[model samples]
Target: MSERLTLPIGPQHPLLKEPIHFRFTLDGETIVDADIRMGYNHRGIEKAAEERTYIQDLYMIERICGICSHTHATNFVQAVEKILNVEVPPRAKFLRTVVGELERIHSHLLWLGVAGHEIGFDTLFMVSWRDREIVMDLLEIITGNRVNYGMNTFGGVRKDMNQEEIDETLKGIKILEERTLYYEKVAREESTFIARVSGVGYLPKDIAIAYCAVGPTARGSGVNYDVRRDFPYAAYDQIPFQVITSERGDVLGRTLVRVGEIFESVKIIKYALKNLPEGPITARVPRKVPQGEATSRYEAPRGECIHYVRANGSEKPDRVKVRAPTMANLMSIRHCLLNQQVADIPIIIAAIDPCLSCTDRLILLKQAGEKEGEILTWEELRRRSIAKKPL
Candidate 1:
């Protein structure tokens, strides 16, 4: 065997969109062992949520992930609504489903573009992102913004869809459907893409399950578990759509699964728009939550995203926890990286569509005269931040 080499990628690599460190041990060009170090992007959003009122927390939580802003917003609101025992209107639920599916379309298209770019297929990247603009425009029309669509509130959606907006969304969806179909054809029939992705970064079904991989990463490995279908949150129970999966268990499988989901999301949006129920959009919600804890699960584009809240009969939650899909899927990445060519690193990592910022939680600081690093609690950290004190 050739001499072993250790390579470090990111906390600041051009290929990485966010700060994360990876140490790969390679035997020649093939990776033999891999390790990951995160927390480079920690912002303490959960602690920030604890310091804000429920309404304010909604705004903060939405900022957790820009692409999946609605996902976090909806998930946070759902947890609060659960604590309040508030029932969302049928129309509101359907509308939430519509927006959720739209977000999925935009996110998947974004991922497709990124994946293409990683594989040096600029044409695919350009075309996929070009079609993604259609979904962004629809989102702007419906929710008044593209990235952070402030659609969710405590009880239900903040805005209701009008006939004009519905018509326009349908028009956009039609174009997206046509474009997505063409892309699907490419994913299925394109020889170059197939050759580049097939058998690359293989994550076997058992390894995927054992690693607790979520979303497309798991689905690509034949783990047919979708939060929308299995748990059925929001209006997912009422919406009719298939859970996309692939048994190929490689980069190709993940690509195919995401493409299939784009079609499914289109179907869901069409169904929700056509069969929208007539009712009030928002329900009356109290300002303060009762003493209780609740967990909210959402099928974000990346995978199963969960939010947990503990209320202390106050305006703000006593504890708030968010489990982004990237965090769950990240566990399986090393397995996929092992024995893979070093050139395959980017694509393998991209296969999970990780949002590193969403996964960050804590950052330890070494204070002056302290031998060990200090781990600050949220309250202490907030106090120090307010006082402008260095840890």
Candidate 2:
């Protein structure tokens, strides 16, 4: 038997893009076991929502993920609106879908570029990011912001996408579609890229399911689950697009899945623009929410992001719990990293494109010096939040 030694890859490491820490037990170059710690930057947005008004919480949620800001913002509001039984208009639905899909494209391109960079394929990284500017410009034009579009509001979208904007967006989509096709070819045919990624991070189908992986991570492993197609949020049901998947269950497979999904996103964007209807973009919403709790699910670029909001007939929510896709996908990354080479760590972790920001939360708490800090579950936390007391 080989003696193994433990190594830390985070808290601060080259492999870590965020502040997540990973402890790996390795036998020589191969990882034998792995554990991850995610709370380094815990911001407690869920608990913070209780202290802020419903409108204020929307902005807080949108900041959860810069890449998938639309997803977080939309899902949070969808849950609030559900508690109020407010239905989103068809036009607003399509507009949200347009921005949402555009976000997906931008996110995937960013991931692809980062992945290429991780594998030392800087040429591919440079090209992918250069093309990503098309989507960035389009998002700015549509939402008046680049990173956090702030398109989503309480009942609908804030941005009223005009005909000129639609035309320009369509043109941008066409350009991205062609670029994706080229990337898809390069990802598959380029020997250098394949040599670095193929079979490097393998997550079998059963293992992926057992880990509760979501989004591209699970889809890459042949798990057929996508919140956009399954739950049908934001005119997704009206849009016609296939759920892109891969059977390879490796880093390369996830890459291909994301690239393919971009093409699908383009199709949805074009269709939504062609069929856009005339109506008010947002509905009037009440300031004080009725007492209710609802869960919202949206397929973000990374995976399914869920928001559970509980209102107590007040301006603020009693509890706003978020389950980002990266939380579920984190387990799969541990499994994928096991038995892999130490050098493969960064690329394997990057394959999931883990958003460590969404994994943590911002808590509303007073400083505890000699005072004992008690760990509270979501239920207990909800109680304190409802009472407007500090933990």
Candidate 3:
């Protein structure tokens, strides 16, 4: 009988860029069990949202995930706009769709680079990131910022695409489409790349469905679901694109799905830019949201990002909740890790493209017989961190 050994990775480790802990129990070189622990970087963004006005909340929400800033902000406004009963202008809707798809391209390219680095394919990493800058530059041309575009508002978008910007964007998209095709070819034909990830981190379709995984993590396992097509938002109903999926249920499968998505995003952006409607960019909306509750779902670059808001006839929301895609996809990580070799851990985890910052949350526990849990103030939380206090 082989002796079982336990291996711990992160909260802080060379393998992880974020603060997440994972313990893997191994029998020889093969993993037997895996456990995940989060909460290392909780910022209490949801609780803070309740105290701020709608406009203020939008700014903070945009910062939730630097990579998915527009995703968070767009979803937040969509929920609040539902309660306010205002329809976004057709032109603004198309503009939002354009920015959203550009962000998708940026995110998938970033993931491809990271995945390449994880498997020691630094050349692929470099070229994918080089092409990624093209999208980043296009985002800056349209919204004046690369990371957080701040393009979304309550009734409409904040900026309109001028003729010069539109021409620049179409030109950039042409370059990106050609570059992504090259990546697809590499991911499909590179012998070493395929050998490294082809059979690693297998997550069957049934297990993925049972674990409620989302994004490429689920699609890679043959689950035909995508929020954009399943529940259209912004200009998606008018935009024509296909949901990419794979039946391989492994790291290589996820790579194929993301590459396919980049092509689809390029298609969506081209269609939106060519068919932009002529209308006002912003619609007048009331300062306060009506008393009601609503939810918004956006197909972020990672997966489905959901935002919930409840209002009580005030400038501030009564409650705010967010369900980031990482939270849903993280559930399947342990399953993927089991029975895999230790050397394959990084690429397997990277396959999900997790943003731990968006997944972590503050959890307040109550003692026995206590009906309510104590809430910690910002000052108290800061002080505890400075003093190295344990939760």
Across residues 305-381, which tens digit of lDDT does each residue of candidate 3 receive? 99999999998999999999999998998899998999999999889999987887554335489777667999987
Worst window of 10 by summed lDDT in candidate 3:
359-368
Question: In lDDT terms, how accurate is model 1?
Answer: 0.92
What ranges in model 1 sit over 4 Å off? Answer: 363-391
Ranking of predictions according to TM-score:
1, 3, 2
Error of 1 at 319 (Å): 0.5
In every candidate, how many clashes are there?
A: 0, 6, 0
Per-residue CA lDDT of model 2 for 297-362, tens digit only, reads: 999999999999998997778999999889999987878988899989889999999888888766
Ranking by lDDT: 1, 3, 2
Cα deviation of 124, candidate 1, in Å? 0.3
- The lDDT for every candidate, in the order shown, is 0.92, 0.90, 0.92
Query: For candidate 2, what is the lDDT?
Result: 0.90
Query: How many clashes (backbone atoms < 3 Å, residues ≥3 apart in a chain or on different chains) does model 1 have?
Result: 0
Reference-based lDDT, residue 47, model 3: 89
Name the regions of candidate 3 deviating beyond 4 angstroms: 361-391
